[model samples]
Target: MTVRIGIDGRVLTDRYHGIGRVTHELVRAMAGTPGVELVVFTGEQSASRRFDLNLMAMLPGVEVVPVALNAVDVRQLWRWRPLLRGAMVDVMVFPYHLGAAPLLGRPAVALVHDCILETDPRFAPSPQVGFAYRIMTALVARTATIATVSRASAREVERFYGRRVHPDHVIGNGVDRLRDDPAAARRLESEYGLEPGYVLHVGAQRPHKNVAVLVEAIAEVPDARLVLVGSADERFPDEVAPAIERYGVADRVTRLPFVPEELLGTLYARAALLAYPSLVEGFGLPVLEAMVSRTPVIASDVPVLREVGGSAALYVAPRCARAWAAAITRLLADDDLRDGLVAAGAAHASHFTWGAAAARLVSACHSLAGTYLAEAAR
Candidate 1:
């Protein structure tokens, strides 16, 4: 018999960030599997967004539906409730860790990507919204089977919620090892006028990204330049300019406006080294992406990075400028260290695959549907 599966669609496509990528990967993999029927529910249509066509070609059983999830509007939630439950969705998977309609009382599985808000307080809103959402996460966790990306995260979830999570489902994130495209790498290097011997940093300039620490560290390395690729946002809105001026190595730091995904692989493949000194992260997908692209990475020794990068990355304290600088210089100067990191990264990255994650999720939905049968048998 075909198992009926419903997914929280907007949660997967709306952002297309870490959460969205995982959600899409899961859905795509499940669609290719046998004996499953998928109905994806979403608030909006992301039809135009670029997707890995390999995903579509692989999974033909999944269908996408557009419906307003009414994230904040209660009336919309109340109104959509009956219709969703009436549709007979055996199981609902919320990949974004957001809420569900009251109608989705069917055995639901919620992917708890991480507790970044708790790990880094600044990511939280003022005491009001922060505390409220944190409480909400706990409530939602209580209602669904908790799915965490790492053992570390699962432990944290259990600790925070003051209860053991359902150990039956703990699926780890997988890296899609990006093969090196030398021509593409060379083109990106030349297009950006980036020097061949530059250290690479990927991610947004968020407060907790701890970019300032790396900035100060880069100052110590006067010879090798630094190329930063990410959303050049205004988080440092006012402080960016003055900080660069004060640092004196502003002349050496080359910043890119924005490098789309196509060009990003090349950038990662050719970098002297990749540095990601964020204070906290949900899963730290970039660390794994860099590894897949054959780049040597030096990252903050945080839980997510450790879980994702393994021994493939050079770990440093987020705020330890001296340590970060020393680490970068070591990677640049020592060819052996760089090669070892690359080898380790490739091996570590090989341990992850989108298919593995999606398959387990498919089974979760099947289990959820079985729960209904057990209840009726009673």
Candidate 2:
């Protein structure tokens, strides 16, 4: 039997961030696969952004339907159900865990990246933000079968809802489909300010990423600068900038924002080490991305990250600034150790491929369809 899936494609644009990247990458992969009819419900295409829409358009029978949703049009939001309901889809798949309300009459599965912005009241945006998140969480918690990137996130979801029921599973995220081309590195790095011998860190300066420890470490290792390749957080720039000044290492630490993902490998390849001391993650994607780039990684010895990094990365206490500095210095001074980690990281990264991830998702969807069919039969 054919399973018709109406996927919410609101995030498919040139302005693709992490969530958008995940949504676009997965849909791109899934559309090409054999047995399913994927009717994509998306926002209007932006002429400005660079995306693989031609690849999406070329797929055998996948349909892309644009949904222009606004605050005023509440009922039209779940346009997939109304538009494709007559098609009688076995299930609807929401990649970002939004639009679950439209799937109420039909069996739907929500790919929940994490419940961090919702479960942690402190990180919750505002009253409006908090309320909206609460509603989304409630929808996922009560109705949809959830799919999470990491076991830690799944456990968090389970605990918050006070459920013995395993509402979510650990499918995990995959990295770029692009092969490791030796020549591509040179071509990619030509434009960037290459820090050939720096300790690299790439991510947003969110409170949870524990970047200040790295700043402190810059004072200890005057020889190497910390290359932060993501945007700075305005709230803590005073706190962060002073640490850079206090350490007398303002020259040693550089912060770059919103870089192209492809050039990331060039940055990683040149790094003496990649430092990721994040306090939280649904899954440490940057670490995995770094691993794929064959960059030696020193990350916090936290559960979710350790699980993602396996034995590939050198792990340390996230809160200990001294420990982070020591790890950076060790990796910097020792080429043999760096080579060992690079070999291990490359091997660890090889275990996660887009094909394998897509297969797991296919299995889960088949399972959901089977359950839904049984209920309909009764």
Candidate 3:
């Protein structure tokens, strides 16, 4: 039997961040899957940063439904049920946390990427936001079939919400193979003044990201240059600039707020190592991205990162600047160690692909639809 699945595509109307990328890739792959038809409900396109929803709509067995509501629009909390029923979908998938209200008697799947807002106060920024997250989490936990990106994240969800995510429902994230471009590498060298073998960090400068510790580590490596590629969060304390100044390494560090994917791939290919000092994460996607680019990685000795990087990355204590510095220096000085890590990392990253993730999601949808239909017939 065909499983007609409905998904919240509002994430596609904005810049493609982690969740947006997951939703976009999964739907794109599911469109080609046999016996599956997708009804993607999207909001009006963003004027400044819109992802092309038409591309997915044009694919076989896929349809796009435009709504007046955005992803974060509070109205969706109550309004989504009727629209979902009207679409006559066998199952509904909420790619993010916000829009998954109880679907009356309908079966729904809620993708819980992480419970950072509930676990980390720094991420919540305010008490009201934290409280709202608790309510939303509780509601979704009771109503929807829970899914997450990693086993580590599933444990976290169980810890906080008392909801268990079965092993089969733990749909992990994936990375694409990035090709190296010599011309783009040269452009980065000339235009951005980024030298080859520089230590690279790619993530938003959030409080939990531990950017200050990375800056401190760079300071200890007198000859090492650093490239930080992500936007700075104003809500949290500004640590990157202050640390760069305090360590007197401003001249050695290049900060780019954003870069096109082509340049980002080149940066990843040209860097000596990718340094990820995040204290916590849902999946640690950058670890896989770097590995696919054949770049060595030095990440925090955190569970989620360990799950993603496996033995392919060199792990360091998240808060230890000296440990990070030593790891960076050792990796740079040892060619054999770097080459071994690159080979292992590439092999490890190959196991994770969007096609595999999409297959898992399609299976989950089929299971939900089959169960619901059997119950209805009874």
Candidate 4:
């Protein structure tokens, strides 16, 4: 029997971020599965913005359905029940926690990327958002089969929501190897004033990202330059700007609010090393991406990063500027050490592939669908 899987593709309608990337890749990967059909529900596009899901929509066994309302709008919640019921799918997958509240008594899967908003309230920009996060997570805990991107995240979810995640449902993330482009390299250098071997950081300037300490560490290594490729949240205090000003290293840093995926691959391919000092994470995706690009990495000694980096990455305290500086300086000066890490990292990153992740997720969904069908017949 074919298992019809309904996916909440609302993330695709917004700006493409980590969660959206995961959904896109997984859907693409599952497109060729033997007995699964994908029905993706997307938000309506406005005159100002349009989402491109052409790749997935063109795939066999995949159907894209556009609802009348935008998923990000609160009005969509009131219409979710009827829309979901009307799909007549065997299983529904909410890629994130927020929209699964209406799926109670249905065979549903909710992917909880992290519990940062609940674990660290400061991560939430406002009290309203924080409260909403708490309520949605609690609702989903009762409504869906919860899954997470890493064992660390599964632990966090269980700790915060008291919901046990099946070991098989801890579906992790994957990365593809980045190709080296010489022409693009030259273009990036000219456009962004980028140096070939500068340190690279590729995430938002959130407080937990610990980018301020990275800035301070860059100050300690005068010859080293840094590229920050993510946007800053104005809702929080500008920690990175103050750190740059204090250290007088404004000239050594290049901050790009955003970059296309192709350029990001080139940046990863050309960087001397990747610095990820995030205090916590659901999964350290940048570490895996950097390793796949054959770049050595320096990440925090946090458990999730350690799980991702293994023996391939250099570990440093998340908050200590001095330690980060020492690690950076040491890694830069030692060519042998960098080469060794590059080799080890490539091998380590190869173990994570989108095919494997998609297989595990499909197996879980199939089981859920079969169980629900049997129960209904009884």
Candidate 5:
């Protein structure tokens, strides 16, 4: 009998951000894996449009099931529970936590990217919202085969749940080099006045992301310009505007709402270094992405960053502006050290590929299926 699998495709909506990209890439790889019939649940009709036919053709043995309901309808979750039940899938994979709805198919595998919601209230619109995520996280931890992107995050998950619910799988996120275009880099340089080399920081201005501290540190580096990319959240404004004004480096900083995919490589390549002083991250993808772009990275000494960047990038204390500035200066001044890091980072990034991550996801799902089957037999 062929084992059936279900995936939540809601993340595929809104142009494939972090979680969405992970879901798409994993599903793309899993389509080739044998003995699995993939069913993707996009809880609303609108989301179906995002999964164009061309993309669907690549995935064999895959079904796209769109619920013909408004997005706000609570029924979207567990509405397809009956359908999944009727199909009797071995495992349903929620690529990210909160993707799990009530009463999902048994032997579910949930990918809890991070416990950021529990760990950082800066992510919450209010205390109630934070509490809700805490409860939701606990539910998934208790009910499913918890899979996470990093061992650090897996430990965080266990910590948040306050118990060893399951031996969470620490499947790392994959890194691939984006397409590079020198012409685009030139244009971006001209457009943004980024002719001089700059330190690139990619990610939202979330408090835990620690962009404010990075900005303060950049002020101390007289020659260094900081390029901040990522959509701004109204709830969590970039709290570093005062620092920017105070440092007299307002002209030195550039903020873009978004970076096109083609120019992302250019941003990485043209940068003197990628400085990621984030206080928390499940997987510091930008570190690996920068490594692939052949840029040296200087990131926080946080466990997750350390785990992901390994020996490929430099690590420093997350909160110390002086420490961050000193690290950036060291990388900027020493060409030999920068060159070595760039080469080592690429070698390190090579160890993480989408194929490897997909294989792990498949293994996790299969293992859960086998366990569920054995339990049923008893």
Candidate 6:
């Protein structure tokens, strides 16, 4: 029997951020899988954005369906329910968990990236957003089988929301191998005012990201400026500006709002080190991306980071600026240690490929649709 999988393709928009990248890559891989027919449901907004309709059009088992409802269009889902029923979708996979309400009785797979709002409420931009996250969490717990990007995040979801009957699976994220692009690096250097030898940090300056520690640690390292390549949080800059001014490293630190993927890989390739002092992460994607880019990583010694980085990355205490600085300085001076880490990181990174992740996703869909247990006798 063929299982028809309906994927919520709202995340396939032009602004392909972390979640969007996960959805796009996983769907592409799953579309190539032998047994299942893949149907992607997209909205009008996505049609106008940088959606991957071209690739879907080329794939053999994939069908792209335009829906009148957006991902968060809970009110519209009921009105559009007939379309889903008519298509005979065996299971629905919501890559972002925003469309959980409409498919309540169906075997729905909810891809929850993180429980930041549930576990770390301070990270939510506003109270209204926090409330909505809580509601979404409840909806997942009540109606769907959950799939998270990391084991750490799965545990968090189990602890906070799905404490009883909701099933959870860990389908980790994957990174593409970086190509050496000297021209891209030179362009970034010229356009973004980035010098060659600087410590690189890639994340939004949220509270839990702990970027200020890097700001302070950079002051202690000699001739190494910190380049932050993410959207700046206004609150974090207030804290970072003070530290940079006090350390007199104002001119050394460079902050770029958004770095395109090709240039990002180049930036990572050119950096002296990738410093990720995040207090928490669902999955430390940048760590793997940096590792694949052949850059040595120094990240916080948190559970999630430890799970993602393994022995490949040098772990530092999250809040200890002195310890972070010491690690950076020591690694920079020791070429042997850096070489070992770079080689080990590449090998560690190869363990996480989209093909492997897509297999896990297929298994999750099989489990949710009851196809595995039912067809075991065959």
Give me the candidate number with maximum lDDT: 3
lDDT for each residue of candidate 3 in 176-249, tens digit (9 for 90 to 100) = 98767888888897888887888999987788788889899999997999999888776777888999999999
Report lDDT (CA) for all predictions: 0.72, 0.72, 0.87, 0.86, 0.79, 0.80
**What C-alpha lDDT, on a 0 to 100 scale, does residue 317 get in candidate 4?**
89
Where does candidate 2 clash, by residue pair? Answer: none
Off by over 4 Å in 4: 13-16, 45-51, 72-78
Q: Rank candidates by TM-score, best first.
A: 3, 4, 5, 6, 1, 2
Candidate 2, residue 325: lDDT = 80
Tell how far residue 377 is off in model 3, in angstroms.
2.1
**Tens digits of per-residue lDDT for model 5, 240-287:** 777788777888888887776668888888889999988888888889
How much is 243 displaced in model 6, in angstroms? 4.1
Per-residue error for 355 in candidate 3, Å, reads: 1.3
Question: How close to the true structure is residue 124 of candidate 1, measured as C-alpha lDDT?
Answer: 59
True-structure RMSD, every candidate: 2.9, 3.1, 1.6, 1.9, 2.6, 3.2
Off by over 4 Å in 5: 43-54, 68-73, 86-88, 163-168, 190-193, 374-378
Clashes of each: 1, 0, 0, 0, 0, 1
Candidate 1 vs 3: which has more TM-score: 3
Clashing pairs in 1: 174-352
lDDT (Cα) of model 6: 0.80
TM-score of each: 0.89, 0.87, 0.96, 0.95, 0.91, 0.90
Superior candidate under TM-score, 1 versus 6: 6
- Per residue, candidate 2 scores C-alpha lDDT tens digits across 137-185 of 7656677778787777787777766533343356778886334445546
Report the C-alpha lDDT of model 4 over 80-190, residue by residue, as the tens digit.
767767877788888876756553346889899987777677888888989987887897788789999999999998898899999999999988887678877987889
Work out candidate 3's RMSD over C-alphas. 1.6
